[model samples]
Target: MTLPYGRDDDSAAYHYINAALRGRDAEAWRLLAADSHVEQTDRVLRAMLDRIAVARTHRTAERATARARAAAGEITQAEYQRDAAEDATKASKTAHFETLLREHHRQIAQAARRLRGDDVRDELTDLVLALGAAVDAHRSAVLAAGYEPTPADEALWARLGELDVPDTDEGRTSVEDLVRRHAERQDDLGRVLAGIILDVAGAATSVPRSALLTEWKKTVAPTLAPEQKTEFAAKGKGSLATERLRKTMGHLERKGLVKRSPDGQRLDLLDRAGLADVADGRE
Candidate 1:
């Protein structure tokens, strides 16, 4: 229908089409260009179908690597299990995509052979129509597999801007460090508690759970702009923030910046300066 896209569009379709046009499959252009039906069928429609397949393939490879790493004990079994479930969902979606994808491939190959003047069975319209229904589903599956965000991550990311956290340069470098803890440990509450715990500790060498929580309820909770204190503060017996703080503190200790007492009564900041950098989202 039209020439392959230039460098401006980074869409997988454009890139795939361009690659086919300029590379080994250049001959495909002539075959597709021969008939209006062929050209239209193999253009954007083909690109969409192929892009979904490619995306699903890349996701499969990434999950394979994660599986290998989990087997070697490079990541926790719990983390692995969570990821495995997500991957299974992706794989299931991919299986559905593959069914439609293979059908389209069969149809296109038949079209190509027919273009070569060979008698080949084909059903372009029916196959294309079926693909429309599956397109959104395929996109959702690929996107979820690509990013791998949990519900906590999505909420925290939204709240980060709402809370105006890291209040430093509005850039990825700082925010990524804030979430990642300088590539040390990352979890559900890990994204937020770094700053809250730091603010609670102030210049104290040691902080107990009671003192830390008291400061959180009285001091930090008041300063926050957002009204979602339920996740960030304990009201009566226990809270999400309470458990998150406990886990985040354990993460801090593993980073070698904090130490927990034998009885878990108090925690000592071992590396104050480094901890500051960690909490502030700095290198």
Candidate 2:
């Protein structure tokens, strides 16, 4: 041990002793702070444990009182039996109603499938292809007949090539008029065919991507196990099948065949007529 420093002396031994004491003092201070934190944490944990114990005791007392009341003449056994029976009846009725609702939904979906028969999509594809061929032929004939294609006619042809059908009422009317006038120049039969084509294309467009996916899920989900369905609903890694769906959607989007929701959580089909045309070899 080193002696304490003299009042006037600045010795090396004094400095060395002071430094050594500082190192030990810092270690002691750290240990004291850690102890203080541990004590505070222990107190908080004890308080929480006490609250839990009190709650458990209160619940136990309540159950004991209820049992005593039932044992006495206050709550009769017949009343208890009646209450239990009523609960059971309500549960049974609720289950039966749920079964009926599921059946109703299944029947409705089946009816919708029958209405949109297996060949409906194929027939729509043929119609789109035929319409596109007629339009292209008419455009060529305009040049052959010594009439330059007007700006409107040129624009309409461009829109057709891009499969950019307008969804609004005014735009639909304009396209109908454009097709009617252009087709009539070829023959009366051409006008009738154009109208039928428009009707088919409109019907096809009415079936949104959500409706298609819902029908697909209804058809396929029953075949999948519970785990498979959960995997399908999950995002990111570990589900190759789910990832494939995402990839296919991405590919369609790149080809301008589909559009995504604002949040990118949903996808919607656009320009079904254009898709049909492409499927039928018009692309």
Candidate 3:
């Protein structure tokens, strides 16, 4: 016999059973069962349809719950990984800065050894003090630039005070100007540093080594003491100038004042400190 929508009777029954199993209208099956000539067969079909409906409902609910749990687990895992990465980065930066500080101390000690004509101990102490002042000025610039000062940073500033570099009007003006300039350039410098760090952290990191060195020299040149500035200018001839410039740039690079691009020719400006930070080795 033909059924609704011109389908044969058997096909109509099959469609009704499928609708019930898929969680569609179960009442349609009941209406179909009422009109069937085979009473016993119709009753069996109705029972099977009811069971399928119930099973479908339960299965759908279970699947939904499982999906929610999986999503939450994924979020938690991602957060953990991000935190771990940040911690490792902080540790590495701290280690690098400490190494720079030690080298600075070593340089002062060597200078003291070379100048044996004076009271060597006093001279060494004075040089260390000067270094400390330079570090302090640099720290002030960092803080002014919105960076949190670490304990090591604080110690460096304190050591600068211990070094009896006379706080002349000119010195004060230079240091204050350096702080202001650094603060102004903080955001730009931060972006550059972030880019550098991201590249270094990536699988195929490659940046031009010399670019950082050149930028460091440029950043610090304006802040150096008159004598040091003269010395640097005088040495900037032929190969000697290149070597001195490289050394100066290297010093600034260690202090985080400059960033290098991947190509090595492009030196990106990262920070600004008046002549003081550069002169004091705080750049």
lDDT winner among the candidates? 1
Per-residue lDDT, model 1, residue 242, is: 53
The sequence of per-residue lDDT tens digits that candidate 2 reaches over residues 49-85 is 3444455456557656655777896888786566557
TM-score of each: 0.28, 0.21, 0.21
CA lDDT, every model vs. true structure = 0.54, 0.45, 0.45
Residue-pair clashes per candidate, as listed?
Answer: 0, 0, 6
- State, as a TM-score between 0 and 1, how close model 1 is to the true structure: 0.28
What lDDT is reached at residue 11 by model 3? 52
Q: Which ten residues in a row have the lowest lDDT in candidate 1?
A: 227-236
For 171-210, candidate 3 gives per-residue lDDT tens digits of 4333334434444444334433434433333443333545
lDDT per residue (tens digit) for residues 157-188 in model 1: 45433332222245333233343342344433
Question: Cα-based RMSD of the predictions, in order?
Answer: 24.2, 28.2, 32.4
Full-model lDDT, candidate 3: 0.45
